[model samples]
Target: MVVAACAAALLAGLTGTAHAVDNLPPDQPLVEDLQSGGKPCATGDDTVYVPTPPRLSAVLYDPEEDNQPSESSPLSGEFEAWWTDADGTVQRRDYSTITLSSGSRQYWTMPSDLPADTVISWHVRANDGHATSPWSDDGNGSVCSFVYDDTNPEQPTISSPEYPTPDEVFWVDGVGVYGHFTVDSPSDDVVSYTYGFLGGPYGTVTAERPGAAVTIPYLPLTSGPKNLTVRAIDRSGRSSSQAQYDFNVKSGRAPVARWKLDDPAGSRSAAAETGTPARAGIGATFGGPAPTGTASTTTVALDGSGHGFLTPDTSATDIRDTFAVSAWVRPAETGRTMTVASQDAVGQPGFTLGLHAQESGALWSFAIGGARLSGGAPETGEWAHLLGLYDAETGKAHLYVNGHEVGDAVAATPAEAAGAFQIGRARGTTGYRDRWHGDVSDVQVHDRVVVPTEVSEHAWRKPTLLGHWSLSSATDGASPEQSGGTPLHLAGGASVYRASDDSCIPDIDPDCTYVPPPLVGDGHLALDGESGYASAEGPVVDTGDSFTIGVVVRLADSAPAHPMTVLSQAGEHTDAFKVRYDPPTNSWQLVMPERDEAGAPERVVSQITGADGGEGPGQRLVVVYDDGTDTIKLFLDGYTNADATASLPDGWHSSGALQIGRGTVGDGWGEYLHGDVDEVQAYAGALRDEDVLGLGGETNPCLC
Candidate 1:
């Protein structure tokens, strides 16, 4: 049904060099006449020919712009192709006639089902009733081409967190969600990704190497639910079906509390008590309860006796036992003596669990028998959590509250005792004499030592209201209620709104509306201030690698260059370290004051800056530093636009405060960061360019 047409110019037996493959008919067209560039084929004489195209190459279905094929071949079509003596002119010829489409190039879309290893063939003929002549012998240009196969071809894959969860009580953990995508084909095809709620935000990630996968982290701030999707694409811009998932965001995880037994100058024993002291103390009423706009409140009425203790149950004391002691307390009045936990002997000197006045009354003293542990200098009317840990092996005792470590002390080994423990009073005499003057609740004691590292690994210590209280007129009016402590004050005129009776806006303020007193035992602090922006999230970082750290910062122009900083000890020892950017430059530079090859601190870091130029109120800046290569770069809105690098100092030491929003001991001091800093982080390694670009796309890594 196909027809071949050749012009009279074809009858010319002119020199072979004067004839072109385009002069051929439809049946024996030149390979150059075909639109498909890469394929293998044989000529009428059974001569093999390869196809090639300029500015492009054959590739596997999954082609990356950086990949190249090994074989070279021309495309296949019904006729042979050739160019006329004039530039920009081409012709095709067959056995009977020549067919040509001058000034028109061939274009074809490969079939999706094309075999991975198949090759195409093309034929050529002379338009002037002459057989196609050899290209090398004929001064005329012949079709040049190349071939391609599925070698090193990659499959369309998705990147994301292995497991994602939503809606919970707590959420601050290093368990991030990220994925790496790659290809196996070495085609010159370009690769990209499409992502969204239904798997959109297409063309977010691009492939540089055939099999190199790209990974990005995911963390949601809002405590809710959301869906996400992602897809892969090839050089031809063809996209694959999207991968999808449902993600839930919740208050991070619970803070972990570890306890160890430390002091006890001498052996201690428990006394037999009548009414269970552990259960008798002011009803367990100490903890952060939701809807209170604050941690729960407790009431304590000191009995005639000036002592209070939460005694342990009989058989509660055992050898090599690990225990945890927690109490929410508020001083009823200045210099008032109150014991939240204690143990006593009816007829002898034994271990006593309770707090006592320091020789100067400047701070409450934690003690067990003749041994004294460390305590904080709490305000006369402030609420606080006084926790204690006693480990016998390392003889290390620690205290923490709300995820921050307070101080440490050493103590003797704990032995088993057959007596009952007391609660809400210093355990001394027999009668209901020593009743505590403050409320105590959620008291738990495990039978083993809780390590400091273990506490760092868990999240529960982070406060979340899981309980409630019923306040009677007598209980609310007569007691130092929840309002008794140092009132939390916000700065910048930020007003604190009660999300509930126990919770408040987790944002910022204009003035001091929230003054979160140190909970003292835990080694961390949570903002008990007005919650702003309706979301609260923090960054997860690893400090082992060099890093540039930055926070979404607002500066007063007059502020110094480095407004905030974070420093970590190189290792177990307090030496060798790196410095990360805090704001503005938001770029990380290595400032290793101590570079000990024997113990050189491998620093890993991350930073941030304003996306929009500085002059505005809420611009964000990102800073980054690579310790391995000592490279420094800065980015606005996750784009690396600026960079600088320098040699690190030798013999650096990191045994200092990991200052936040301010420097530890230099240039930027007392300079409280102007803008709100959310999601601060440090990394253990260097981040790639694609990773940075990926963060800027509509598909945010932190999105749920």
Candidate 2:
């Protein structure tokens, strides 16, 4: 009876406690909206495309947490997501978390398993463990939607009325050719196009909308085979396959007179390949070495004796407005005025293309009446191509040497001249003076000012390739020459091996280091300091004339005990020229003996100091002996080393075999290099500064 009474009292106490406790549920969580990629989700029929996986997010609120006074008020603990596809397929995802603040943001990234190019509707709801909020909507009881799209846009369609056909060649009417291109995308998603000429920089053009056609204007500076590539880009930053457009451009204008000067010995007249014939003066002698380096053609030699000149028909004197004159001349003398071609005026010639004597030195000059424009210093005994132009529209006189413009153009009007066109001499106040004292070939006169592109073409007609040793592929210790010259035989431990990395290709590779075309073939040649060397037949190059020699080299030892020789031409008693590294000064040196005979007291050495002479990446080292200017220049990586340049008035011929990896000391070979070498090129004529830079950069000197 006592136990039953105690249970009844306990039951009455529990019943009173339950009535005193609060039993109200937390206010419903407030669902705001859903977002994708930090942006509000697309509503209605609109769908947003994404490049990568879509990241969805939402801002949530809890009314119960907002009403509470304490900062630690209970908040939503988890979220539920519902996604419906176009086919009514429903998918759910639950995300659990610790109690959040009253108002906080939450995010969820879509899974990679989501199908691409498909539209899907998605919504989010808040849950606080006790109760759940309604799903988010676009305020109209509709879920937000988007489309996953990772596909690239379709290829662009390119067309140009100026260059209609890809296989046909188009002629340039003036200085340059312009093509109006219309680019269109087959896919409606494309919004822009990226276009560029092959081997050039790319540019972009935007369209008004998807599938809209865009027009672009393109102008090519030089005439040649052209290839334009266009790619369509969509809003998702996806690029389509490139569409290539191929065409060719050629110069339309031709020279009025073209004198090849290939007349045989004892010929009294020189026939013009395009215009009238010219009569050779008393001292004009034919049958000299031609710039083409071919036996079929010859140059006219001049003695500078008053009578060494050529007079063309009176029709050549008809010069008033724009005109141009060009010729390949090898002057034998300097320090005085020497004319290559001129037309007589009153006190002075109307226009004279020749060397002008100045207090500083004799410089390449183009004169229109009294207005004289001097270019770089002229090198005697070296073949150089000179072009003088008078542009009436700009009222300027321009001069170019070796396919490159000299100094700035001078403003001048053409002087009136009616006398016969004279070659090798210009008329002064007294009489015919300033006679040329050398050889001249390939004289051309244009009725109109030739464009820079065409001028370069005429100037660099063809580089005489004396020898080219690629050192790429070797068999039986012999490396074949590329220019049909003698093969190089390896001695000691010299070997050909492939390069470890791909050489720099302009517009493709990030690095701008220039690798000669030959080196891009198979491999480079390696040499051991002790005895490894390569040798070819005697007289690979005529050292006495203006010539260019270059090689891509890298040292194996940063600081060696002795100097290292990369290239040299051996003479009977000593080396005619040597491109080597001097460790004592940490410099690259261009060494030439004062005399070919032994025991020469002095050595002409041009050294480039403070350069990378260590075991670093390969560099292009070129030595140009410009006999016309009597200068020897050293270039490293396509840049001139001004401090290492000097005047070398003359050089003696070296008849001994060309030596690689070693140079001649006293009467024997020494200073052997321990490094890798490739792309050994020797040209009969000196290359211009641009050519040297091109050899070390992306531009092809020969092609330019």
lDDT of each: 0.36, 0.75
User: How many residue pairs clash (N, CA or C atoms closer than 3 angstroms) in each of the candidate models, in the order given?
Assistant: 191, 3
Per-residue lDDT of 1-704 in model 2, one digit per residue for the tens?
99999999999999867733432333333333556655566755456667776777766666552344544434453445456766888876666555665467666777787777766667666655555566665254446666677899989888888766545445433333456789998899888999998556579999998779998876555666777899998866689999988766665457778788889989888998888889998799998987754223789998999889988845464567778898998889887999999888776788899998988888888988457888766677667789998876567888988777888988886768987788999888888999999999988888666777776666654446677777877888899887566899999979887654555575787667644333345578888888999998777778887778888888876677788899898778888889888877887888887787786654646877754545566788998886655678888888776676898876677898888999887667789998888888878767877778766322236634
Return the top candidate by TM-score.
2
Candidate 1 residue 383 Cα shift, in angstroms, is 3.0
On lDDT, the leading prediction is 2
Compared to the true structure, candidate 1 yields what TM-score? 0.30
